[model samples]
Target chain A: MTDVLTAAPDVAEIGRGVLVAVLLAFVAFGAIPVVAGLAQFLLIPMHAVRNHYRETGPYLPNVAVLVPAWNEAAVLTASVDRLMALDYPPDRLRVFVVDDASTDETPAVMASLGERFPGRVVHLRREKGGEGKAHTLNHGLREILADDWMEALLIMDADVIYAPDSLRKMTRHLADPTVGAVTAYIREGSEDAHGLTRFIGFDYLAAQAASRRAQNVAGAMACLAGGAQLHSRENLEAIGGQIDTSSLAEDTVTTFRTQLAGRRVVFEPHARVLAEEPAGIDALWKQRLRWARGNVQITSMYRHLWFRKSVHPGLGGFFFGVFWFAILLLPVAMLLTSIGLVGLYLLDSDLAATVFGAAVFVPVATFVFMITMTISVDPRVGLKVWKEALLFPGVVSFAVLTGATFPMLVPWGGGDSSGWTLFVYSWLVLCVPAAFLVRKLELTRWGHRLAPLGLYLVGFGPMMCAITVDAYVKEYRGAAMTWDKTEKTGRVSV
Target chain B: MSRGRTTTDRATAAIVRSLAARPYRISSPVVLTAAELAARGGVLPVWADPMALADETEADRLRERRLVAGLVVAIAVVVLLWTVRSLLM
Candidate 1:
């Protein structure tokens, strides 16, 4: 009778223990993307130490700036003019505009620029146009390598406007014998940049600029941004003079090759270029899809490079591994955690909410804090970036929606599985796209940022994942490696 | 199959074997960027490829590390669920 009296109370306590343990495991795996921010956090002290670029005067290498153009009459002339104005010596700086049979006035513009600048500008017009950016870049690279005098090569886009001193800063890194390639801070300068651009501009601060700074400490850089990547003659020769046509991510392949060859690829914050991103959601989707696809391609191409002794430890081993496991697996991990929480909720409602809420809030709160720290990389931009924090609610909602998936899924141990629980779980699962239902409201930044919150939900995370999935399937099916270029408007000003 | 095996390979193989023998991180997945921290912490270097053996003594430590981690996770999940069944259900 005494043992029976105590057993009743012990049962309730044990229920709580099971709930606690499962909830603990759910949070542990799910919150990885947020936790990955700690990689930058630890680098705070190291990054705080003053960054000093070497003197620009003596280190300037003869640079052949290659701009591959197709239907770029909109931005080519202004871009060429800006390139001409760059601080490097006129004799040292040669601009090659490889026109891939543009139907527009691009051919005419290229012809006129060549006539005006004479020897300074070279235009190679091709009859066929469908060949990708890599082929056009290769056409220029072949001639450049043949010349042998071109000490350094710059692979830049047609719409980007470079600062007068940008060449000097980017090229200086090549002076170090061990340094193979360098990329600059490519900032969006679109005058009519939609809210998508603002959010992305804010995002690039952490995603590109700040994150690269942290990765720089490990001698790892994930990619040489396509807009303003500079490469040394010898380094190009090591990887073959032409960029790899095997993958969509030519720059990323080059970055990996340089590291594998034991050369450092540096990301210089001081070297900046202004370029335009797609101002509309449709265009942004096309642009980001290509990038998403390319990254997936790079991961496949360099799958052998991860955590290998043959390659350097930085990009190949550590940073690329982080990008693969930490960043890419984010949505899947979060989704699983949500399912686990649902199972726990079936066990006990109040304890489930409390425990699940704790797991969800920590990463959400930590991510917001990470975004704030990332924005501080530029105080002027940082000021406007605080508005992005308002999206914190949307961010929190993301976690909640993720955790609420299959909310009625309780194993119930030996007990009969309840239909009511399954019904509730199915109902809760419908909220996954609930943001779309409210898209018309256009209440806050979601209306203005990236896409309407609903569309962004599909495009940014799930769409990117889907695109990667498709890319792998397509690659396995032997899809053509056509260089699909994102259309750039001439709206940006440096 | 490719080339002559050097002494450096043997030494690295010995070091990796020793490192693998050490204890694993307590609840490593909970730490999120645990791999990043470990890599940044300077304790883990770029080891040889998964397919390559440092020497006959080399245990392919990476495989062992991953195996142990998977087991821990599997055991934890099972124990948690089973305990819940015994205690509550």
Candidate 2:
């Protein structure tokens, strides 16, 4: 093994080429989203300046707010009480608490509220089905849309607490005929929120700010998150008010659909709501898995949307699919590529070492830029917290490995139990497509854990790590769909 | 308080069960605290409209973040590989 550092130049050239290729890829990946996002960001401000908050007309539309709850007995009454206290004109706004056949006293509480608020508060219930939130929401929408006076519907979660003016602020956007849906800024609620919650909270604000701004500029928003999304009754009926029950990311899919129909989905910055954040890692992981899975489902279902070449390709459907696929598959790609590069380098030290410097620089630069941007969005988390967020890539790698190895360990059953697997499978599918499909079939047929072997290797291993980073990035990227549902550790009487 | 369950308690149970069940469904709602509901009802109009307000640089900020994140992931992976090699050798 004569060390002939003689071939160093050749190795350097190859390494340089690899580095350039990687950087170009990274740039290509980052540029589309960045440009599209910036276009929206810049355009919205311009439009706002042009419009100058002029009230086009009076006729404030009536809103039907739907809060779908299950097993939230602990925080229900306070949530309801808060809901009942909304500031919209009683004649214009209606509140519906849809009970998904809770095995608890939720029915009684909803009943009591129905009694107290009468016409203002409507209570509806659903029977158990393999279908998830989509079924319950459809049931509610069918009933609410049946009423002609309800001009729009606000889709909310049980955990979200809307500001007094939130409904009113959200409603005004619908006055513009072009606007089909409106979603609001979600703020972090609890101070004692754990690390997971804090990360999610910071990520939420930053994403809302970015996505809404981007959408506003682009004139085509990606999604109206479930937290506090306001939908025009006309828009809902136009697109079939019943959400896609089969797809996981119904809100996102719906948003895309509305945008496709030539209607705009607005991301309102001023309209704010506070929702729960997951308290622990497990909860956070499961929650994210569901979100990621839902997004994948939507991406798959709307694969056709991406196929249309005429729309703004960068911000258009095609880019969305590519990004979705990349976002999910990238961690694995990174891991595999990194391994390959390193292995090649180790085998040929002079060659690998020569290229390493260039290969690493471009991606790192991009990472720094992303981190700086994320920190700017949520100053509450501060720069230091952003440093923590930087650790996300590592976590994502772990999640990727775990997901790849243990795709089937995820729950396949329908309903509440399915929620867990839905979450897990969502993450797993990103890294392990085959695993995801197998589990999808298994879970679709029955509701149980298939094998802990897949779970141990993928679900709990490097998959965990990959997921951590993915979650953090999603948070910072403002890509996360809902606020973390923080489990209240202390009792506070509101 | 016969401990039968306050409206709040019942509501909490309903919400939890609704989220945890198979269908993950819930009942249509009634306004419980008119005061709170009224307050929420009002604030929405003063602020929430995407078309109405400027994006205020938030989206650009997020795009920059993703760029940075991608870069960081690249570097970290490189560094990690370097560190492990250094240790092993």
Candidate 3:
């Protein structure tokens, strides 16, 4: 009986050791995103040394601009005007507006544009429309390709305003035969910018100006901006001469195909394209949900290609795979980290506190590094959206980070505060659901007034994570793919 | 000192001359005088101008330097904060 009692203690000790190890594993797994994000931000500076501009030349090809219009009369005329004003060889550029059976004044606008710029702007109407952007683009692609006059095809949304020099900058990369495709840096250009729009501006600065530069250095692009992706005729033919219509993310599929087919897809950061983003949280959620779901679809579709260098070097390598999954599986990682931290707290509060104290500095450093680097990329936008950038992780998380950074400042008495510690540990998991609640709040009349405040408090990062979680749920349920078009009010100014 | 050359044209000519290494020339017919090009249904090829391209390249290089400088500043700030925290602790 004494031996059995002694053995019980030993067994309990072993179980405790195993639990601690498992919790540590979870915490470590959660750190992957923070580490990966920091690595990506760090790579942005490397673009100064390693970039694709050395091979670029002043190569101006006969470019055909394809615009797929669906009830876009409000913005179509302005978009076409901007295209007409591009600083390219006027004779070399032709605008093809594929009118997808518009219920608005798109037909009249196109007719007027056609008359105003005869032989330059041609309108191709689709009697049967509303399939998706890919189908509409394919229609124009067919017509553009049929006439052997086009050397390169520029696929753009109906609402985007290309900078006068954006096309030339993009075409410069195509000067190198190895570069089959090029995407421009898309900026959020809302004339009367609100808090949400400002947040979007900062988001674009991080995603495009900062992240795409790193992608260029790494030689693996995630996706071509739908607003401004330029493709060589040869590349178009190589990738089956049409955009992939099977997935919501046709742009991503096309980008993946271009890379997989041994052709280089370049990101021209200097080529700035201004796009109108969704101004409302609900609208943004729906738009991002489509993109998020598309990413999920892409993850599964290209399951075989990841981490296999024989498939392709950059896209199949470990760095690219980690970066890709780090974003796609962020919510899962957050959940695991929260569960582990909370579980540890329940078992051993002191040990949990120690682990969290040490670990919190990583995210603090990363956030600082990432925000500074991102703002520096485009100081003009950054200056305007600095508040949004600072609150990007949400106000509460930012507070947590700040407190973690300077523990002396926080009035926790440097004593036992289990309640506060538990809240901090659980915040990671709670933030996602809180972000979803913010969206629901926007639907209520009075709550709509407070939604912006809620967004600021919860943070855009958590909201995006929430959207990603929604994408997973919808995808798992086999939800019908609906093309939810964001309403454009011609608010984008050059 | 061409008869029809404006002050802008003269400046462009001087800039072109300064670039003796590449010896800039308006080789494309798209770079013809605006009126002449407009008569042929072509727009002025401002993008093809050698001097403009060079200026853009210089600007891009400057931006890259700025990015690197910003990164250095960020790292320095982070290190300073860490040092202060360590000292305090």
Candidate 4:
């Protein structure tokens, strides 16, 4: 009986040790995103050395501009006018607007544009519309591909305005025979900029200006920007001659297919295209949810391709997989890290302190490095959205980071047993839900006044995490995949 | 009599002069002359010097190198501050 009693304590101790080990593993899993993000950002500098410009030439081909329109009367006129005024050869450059049976003034506007620009602007009307962007694009692609005149096809959104030199810049990449497609940087060009637009501006700068540069260095791209993707004739036909309509991310599907077919996709940062983004939180949420869901779909669709070098080196490599999943599964990582930290604090305060104290510096250093490098990529946009950049991880999380980094400045008692430490540990788990609440508040009567403040407090990163969580839930539930188009007001200024 | 310089030749000369002047200073290895541009039936934009584009890429490379150096220095300073604080504590 005495031996059993003594053994009970030993067994309990062993169980406790096992739990601590498991929790620590969770914490380590959480650090994957932070480390992966830093690695990707570090790769951005390597683009200076490993770029495709050397292989590029002054290759200008007979380019057909494909504009897929559905109730885009508000922006089509300006968009068509801008296309007509592009610096490329007038005879070579033609605008093909595939009208998806608009009930609005779009048909009338298209007729006027057709008359105004005659042969330059050809209108292909889809009587039976509402099939989505890919179907509409394929409708036009069929016509454009039938005529052998189109040496290269430029697929762009109806609302985006291409810079005068953007087409020439993109075409230069296609000068290389091996290069399949090129994407231009899509800058948020809202004439009346708000906090939401400013946040989007920073997001674009980080995602396109910084991350895409890193992808260029790595010789693998995630997706071609839907607003400005330029494809060679052979590339389009090689990828089965039609955009993949099975997924919400047709651009990504096309990108992956092009790369898999042994052709390179390039990102030309100098080729800037201006796009009007969603100005409201609800609108932004809808758009991002679609993107997040698309990512989830792509993740499953390409399950066979990841981390397999034999299939393809760049896309299937370990680094690319880590980069892809770090963003895709970020929310889950945050939750695991939070749960682990909080559990550790409850189980053994001293050990928890030791682990957190050691782990904190990496994220802090990475955050600083990433922010500085990302801003440096596009200083003009960075200067405007510096506050948003800093507040990306939320004000409260930033406070925690600051305190953790400099314990002397914001002392949380020598031991990590303080309420402040516990709060810090719990904040990661809380932030996502709080972000969802912020979005919910935006739907309320006093939303206009309070939502912006709430968003700032919750931070854009957490809000994105919240949208990702929503994507997961909706995807699991097999919800309706309604194509909620973002209403555009032609607010993009050159 | 020397034939009057066509628009293409003038444009080509202008491009050559611009390349020779000031910062560009480098002679073109592959001159995409305005005759070629006119043959393609496209007028080159005022800023569209194909050779100068290569120079711009080189300039961007330099700028990126400087930025990376700045990043390294900033990271070092952060580490130094953290070390100092840890020691003082």
CAPRI classification of candidate 1: incorrect
Which whole-number lDDT from 0 to 100 does residue A297 have in model 3?
A: 95
**lDDT (Cα atoms) of all candidates against the true structure:** 0.63, 0.55, 0.87, 0.85
Task: Please give the lDDT score at residue A338 for candidate 2.
Answer: 47
Expressed as tens digits, the lDDT of each residue in A1-494 for candidate 4 is 99999899899999999999999999999999999998887788777678777766656678899999999999999999898888765667899999999889999998898899889899999999998899999999999999999989999999999888788778877877677899999989998878889889988988998899999999899999998999999889978899999888889999998887767899988788999999888999999999999999999998977887545668878999999999999999999999999999999988888999999988887787777877877788788888988888888889888888777778554654378888889898899999999988999997767998888888999999999999999889989887889999999989
Instruction: Give the TM-scores of the predictions, in the order they appear.
Output: 0.71, 0.62, 0.93, 0.90
A1-494: candidate 3 lDDT, tens digit per residue: 99999799899999999999999899999999999999998999898878887777767788999999999999999999999989888888999999988899999999999999999999999999999999999999999999999988899999999989899888877767677799999999999998899889999999999999989989899999987899988789978998999999999999998887667889988888899999999999999999999999999998877776556668877889889999999999999999999999999987887998888878878888888999888888888999999999899998887777787877983688777778889999899999999999999998999999999999999999999999999999999999999999999998
Q: Give the TM-score of chain A, superposed on the true chain A, for all candidates in the order listed.
A: 0.81, 0.70, 0.99, 0.98
Candidate 2 per-residue C-alpha lDDT over B1-89 given as tens digits, one digit per residue, 9 for 90 to 100: 12243454455345434423423111132233656547666543322333332242333233333433433454465566556544643
Which 10-residue span in candidate 2 chain B carries the lowest summed lDDT? B22-31
Off by over 4 Å in 3: B1-45
Q: Residue-wise lDDT of candidate 1 within A359-448, one digit each (tens)? A: 543453444445545555555665665555334334434533333332333344124444433433333223334433333334345555
User: Which residue runs does candidate 1 get wrong by more than 4 Å?
Assistant: A1-26, A50-57, A316-320, A389-482, B1-89
TM-score, ranked from best to worst: 3, 4, 1, 2
DockQ score, prediction 3: 0.15
Residue pairs of candidate 3 with colliding backbone atoms:
A394-A459
A352 Cα displacement, candidate 2 (Å): 3.5
CAPRI class of candidate 4: incorrect
| Per-residue accuracy of model 2 over A76-128 as CA lDDT, tens digit each | 77777777677555666778878887777878888888888888888788868
